[model samples]
Target: WDEEPFELIVSNPPYSVKWVGDGDATLINDPRFAPAGVLAPKSKADMAFIMHSLSWLAANGTAAIVCFPGIMYRGGAEQKIRKYLVDNNYVDAVIQLSGGLFFGTSIATCIMVLKKGKSDNKVMFIDASKECIKVTNNNKLTPENIDRIVDVFAKREEVAHFSHLADYAEIAENDFNLSVSTYVEPEDTREKIDIKKLNAEIAEIVAREQVLRSEIDKIIAEIEG
Candidate 1:
């Protein structure tokens, strides 16, 4: 197939695959991967498809791709590819989806939105990991959930625990790790503990135990006498 840029691209590329193996290293020189300056590991072709799609992305086009979570944070060549994408300001946003949203597996997937002609150098991250309803054996994303995500994405606003807009400098400070959790904080759900009250209760219990022990000793002594 020829590398021709398109106005739009959408794909749910295979999460991971061993593309080059057994000392076959021909892909390292592929023009599509030239911008990344490195080839994705043989065991993981996630970046391969990303770079391929990006190579053919039109200047005014956008590509929405479903990706394995690992590609956002894994080290080595994948990290380098992410650096290229981030440094060049090609990545528009990364949306984290709820786990179990897909059939046959419960792995949480993420969507990476790429644009060749971006107006800004920031990347928006949406933590939609909880935006789903459990239906029987898997989770389902309702229209409301999708709308909420799209709203934040379109606005590019920062919502507490739900979304964040991180600039290139911030991403660089983070070593180009595009994991949503790294940028958008999750809501804390665990019950908050009052340490002072708990300590007072423990002290009261100890005092009551001592008093009961003393009373029991006196009763035993009286019985013996």
Candidate 2:
């Protein structure tokens, strides 16, 4: 803000309905609003809230905004705004939380970290969806779980199917889809199977069938004779 000199800005913004979108013209012209375009369909007010946070961000300060996953990859106004920010390299990190984290809704959410005047030309993404365990019926991020995520982001490590550092060019190639899942895939839960075990079972069954056929052949021959 013009009156304050803050370093870091972080908050949990509202992600709800009745948000201004393509129906408004002022949003399309605002320079601080990133893409100079419109937001996607019925995403509630996620992008609008993000834009507000981005504008208040200091030259060297950082702001973390919580939003629904739609803003990352949706087309139209939302994509345009995101492209503008990413193209200029304002995005720092996008952390996706697991489903069931929020009650009354099963939708997974993501946190967008933005930094002004960043020297690094890369964006960090963390797939933290599986990091938290469920509490009662709602999933929550434990202190250690939060620490783990923060550590990963700070270290910028290349984790397998977890975190990734992507440049603006790569994001552009992906049409500005910043969905955490797009960059960091959730760990595949499909159980690893043993091919040898399957083959052995199949072979045993075939051998038993062969013995049964032999017995049937002998019985038919004896009866005919």
TM-score of each: 0.91, 0.87
Model 1: lDDT to the true structure: 0.91
At residue 13, give the lDDT of candidate 2: 72
lDDT of 2 by residue, 1-225 (tens): 375545788878767656666567665577655354555445467777777777777788889887878778777767877887887788999998888887688888888999987878899999998898878888888999999999999898879898999988888889999988788766779999899999999999999999999999999999999
Pairs of colliding residues, candidate 2: 35-80, 35-81, 38-77, 39-77, 39-78, 98-129
For model 2, give the 10-residue run with minimal summed lDDT: 34-43
Q: Please, what are the lDDT tens digits per residue for candidate 1 over residues 168-206?
A: 899999989999999988789999999999999999999
Question: In model 2, what lDDT does residue 205 have?
Answer: 100
The clash count of every prediction, one per candidate, is: 0, 6
